[model samples]
Target chain A: MAIRDDFEVVASQVRTVVQRFALGLLVIAAFGAMLVGKADTVLVEHARVLALDVVSPVLEAIARPVAYANRAIADLREFASLREENARLREENARLLAWQTAARRLENENEGLRSLARFREGPEASFITARLVGDSVSAYMRGALLNVGRRVGVAPGQAVVTGEGLAGRIAEVGENSSRVLFVTDVNSRLPVLVERTRERAILAGDNSPRLRLTLLPSIAGVQTGDRIITSGHGGSFPVGIPVGEVVETSDGSVRVRPFTDFSRLEFVRVVDYGVTGLVGTGAAAPAPATPPGGTAVRSR
Target chain B: MRVDGTLAILDRWGRAALPGTVLLFFVLLTLAPLRAPYLSDTLPLLPVLVVFQFSLAAPERLPGPLLLAMGILLDLLLGGPGAPVGVSALGFVLVRAAVMSNRRYLVGVPFLFQWAGFCILCWGFVALVWAFTTLWTWALIDPVPAILQYVVVVVIYPLIAPLLARVRARDPLNVPELSRGSARPGETTP
Candidate 1:
C-alpha cells in the first residue's frame, strides 16, 4: 500500500510537470506559427499546396452527395413551379425577342461606326466550366475549390462567374484543382464602373457579403440599386460583366449586393481574358490569348 | 497494470481517435458556411470547442501543444483570409489555458456555468481573430460581424454540447477508473 501511494504521487507530479511543459510548448508553437505565416516561406507554401493536392480528391468525394442533394432540391423546386416558370419564360422570351431585334440594329450600327474608325479587334474570351468541390467558409476567409485546374487552361487572375454574374477570380491553380478567391475575400479588388453615370470605383472586399466601393468621386452619380460593371481598366477582367447592384448600408456606407448568390454556388465558368504575366502558379507560362495592339476583350 | 484485454485495446486506440475525430469533425463543418438567417460568412471554430471540452474534462488526453498544432493545421487548411498563421493556434492555446486554470470550477460545475465559461472564453478568441485580421489588412474590420459570430457560436454550443457529451459518455480513453491505473499519464495507453 505504501509503495502504491508513492507510485501515485510520483505519477501525479510527473504528469503535472509534463502538462506544464506541453503548455509552454504550445505557447511557443503559437508564436512559431505567427512567425512562419508572416515569413511566407516558399517551402511552407509548397507543403500546403501538396497537402491540398492530397486532400482535394477526398473533399470531392464528400461533395458528390452534397451536389446530388442540391440538384435534387433544385429539381423539386423547379417541378413545383413548372407552370408558373413556363409562363414567366414565355413572357421573358417574347420581351427578349423584341430586345434582340433592337440590339441587332444597335450592333450593326456600332460595327459600322467602329469600322469607320479603324478600331482594333478585341481579345477573344473563352470559358472553362468547373465544379466547386470544396470551400473554406470561415468568417475571416472565403474561397472555393474548383475541380478544373492548370490542365484545363485555368489560370490565376482568370475571372469566375455563374449564370447570375461574377462570382470570383482564380487565385491559385494546381495540376488538377484550383482555388477561387471570392470577390468578398479581403485581398480581392476589381475596377468597376456605375452602369448609369460611368463613374469608376474600386470594389474592395472587407470579408463582408457586400463589397465596398473605394475611390468613387464624392459628386459621382451612384445611387441605390445602380448596376455596377467591370471597367476593364487594369486588364484583369474584360469589361461590361455585371458585378452587382449598389446599396447604401444602415451606416450610410456604400456596398454592392453581388449578382451571384454565393451560398447556392455549385458550378462556375472560369473565363480567360488573356492577360499575360498575371499571377499564376503554372510552371510553364502560357501566352495570353491577347491579340496584338492590347485590345481588351469585352465580356457579357 | 492490464485490465480486461479488450478494454485496454479500446482505451489505447481511443486516445488518438477521440481528439482526432473531434478535430476532423470541426474541419469538415467549416467547409460549409452558415448563411444569412444565421450570421453570414461565419463558422464556429470546431477545434476551439473540442479543445475547450478536453481541457475541462481530460487535459491529459489533448495537451496544450496538441491543440496548438491542430489550430495551426486548421489555419493552414484554410489559408486565403490573410489571418496570421498562428491565430487559431494561439486562440486554442488560450482556450486551453483558460479552461485549465479554472478546471476545478469548470469541470464539476453545473452545465450552465460550464457553458457560460466557454462563452466567455470565446470572446477572447474572437477578439484575437479580429485584432489579427485588422493587423493583417492594415484596416479595422467591423467588430460587429466578429461579435455576431461569437454570439452565434455561443448559441451553437448548446446544440453541440449534447454531441460532445455523447462522445464523452462513450469514451474509453479517460474513464475515471482508467485514469487512475498503473499505466499513469504520459503513457500512450490510458
Candidate 2:
C-alpha cells in the first residue's frame, strides 16, 4: 500500500515537470515570434539574401529541366493549335515582309536626311543576350532569374529588355545568376514619360499585372493609347526605351500595357553599359547632348 | 541467422535512422527541380509523412526536443518567409497530444477515422496560418484544391501507416511498452 502511494506521487511529479517544461517552451516561442515581428533589421535581410544565394544555383539547375519538360509538354499540346493557326501565320508573314521593306525604305530616307544635315550620332550601346532561367509570380513578388550574372557583366540596376521592349532591371546579382524585378512588382518604381505629350510620371506597381502612373496631376495631359517610355530623369534607365502603352480604365485610372509579355517571357537582352560611377562620370560622359535646353522632344 | 543479425542492426538503427531518412527525402524533394507543367502549388508530401510517423510511434520514446529541432531545421531548409517548420512541428505535437490524451477512445477507432483526423488537423493549422499571415491568399483563393489535397493526404495515410507501425514495432523503446501489455495475456490485473 505504501509503495503504491509512492508510485502515484512520483507519477504526479513527472506530469508536473512535463507540464512546466511545455509551458516554458510555449512562452519562449511566443516571445521569439514577438521579437521577430517588432524588428525589421538589416541582419535578417542579409541572412535571407545569403540563404537565397546559396540555394539559387541548386534551384536554377532544377528549374532548367522542369522548364524544358514543361516546354515539351506545352509543344505537344500546341501542335493542333499550331496547325490551325498555320494559315493565319502565313498571311501574317507576308504582311510582315511587306512592312519590313517599307521600314527599310524609310530608314534609308532618314539616314539621307541626317547626312545632309551633318548631324552627329550618339555612341552605340552594346547588348548581352541571355535566356530566362526561372520566374516566380507570387502575389507579393513578381520576379525572374536569368542565367547571366556578374561574370557576364550583368549588374544590379542594369535594364533588361526583349524584342518587344523594356522588361525591368536586375535587382539582385549572383555569380552565375541574377534576379530581375519585373515592372509589375509592388516595389518597382520607374520614371516614365508619355510618348505623345512628353508628360512625365512615376510608374509604380501595386502587385498587379497592370502598373499605375502615379504623381500625374489631375491636369496632366494624359490620354488613352499614349505610348510610355523611360524618361531618363532618374538616370538609371536609358532615355526613350519603350515601356508600354497607356490604357484608361472605366474608373478613369490610367495603366500601362507593358511591351514585354511577362507571361511568355523567355529570352532577354541585358544592355552592356558600364556601371555609372561616382558623380555619374561613367554614365554622363557617354551622353553629352540633351537635345538643347533639356526639354522633352516629341517624336514625329 | 545472418538475416536475423541484419534485421537486428536495422532495428537498432531505426530510431534515429528513420527520421533522418525522412528528413533527407524531404531535402531532396525540395531540391528536386519542378518543371512548369507539374503541379507547383500543392503542399509537399513530407509533412504528412512526419505526422503519420508520429501517430504510429510511441510518444514517450520520441523526444520532444528532437521533434522541435527537426521543425527548426525544416523551417531553415525550406525557403519560406514565415515559420512554416515551427508551425508544422507544433501542429504535429498538438495532434499527437490529442491522440495520446484520448488514446482509449481513439485506439479502437477505424484507421481511416484516425487518418482523417490527422489530415484535418494539418489542414486546419495550414489554413489558420494562411488566414493570419495573409500570404498566399491567391493560391488558397480556391479552397477546394487545399481541401482536395487534404483528402488525398488522408487517403495515402492508410498505405503508409502500416509500414510505419511495423517500424515502430521494432523500436527498442516501444518494445518495453508492447511487452508489458502482452506478457500475461488472459490474466487480468485489477
For this target, which candidate reaches the highest lDDT against the unseen true structure?
1
Candidate 2 lDDT over A1-300, as tens digits, reads 999999999999999997767735743563353345224323333443454456566666776777677678779988969976898899999999999999999999999999999998643567888776655433234567677777878766677889988898776566766667778765567777888888777887665668888767552478778889988664446678998988764454788888887766767998755543311211112124433212111111
Per-residue CA lDDT of model 1 for A19-46, tens digit only, reads 6587677777788778776666444555
Error of 1 at A140 (Å): 2.1
| Candidate 1 docking band | acceptable
Best by TM-score: 1
Q: By DockQ, who's the top model here?
A: 1
TM-score of every model?
A: 0.81, 0.63
Native contacts recovered by candidate 1, as a share?
0.57
Q: Residue-wise lDDT of candidate 1 within B82-125, one digit each (tens)?
A: 45777888888888777766655575458998888988888888
**Residue runs of model 1 more than 4 Å from their true location after superposition:** A1-19, A41-44, A74-86, A112-117, A218-220, A223-225, A248-254, A278-300, B1-11, B33-42, B169-190
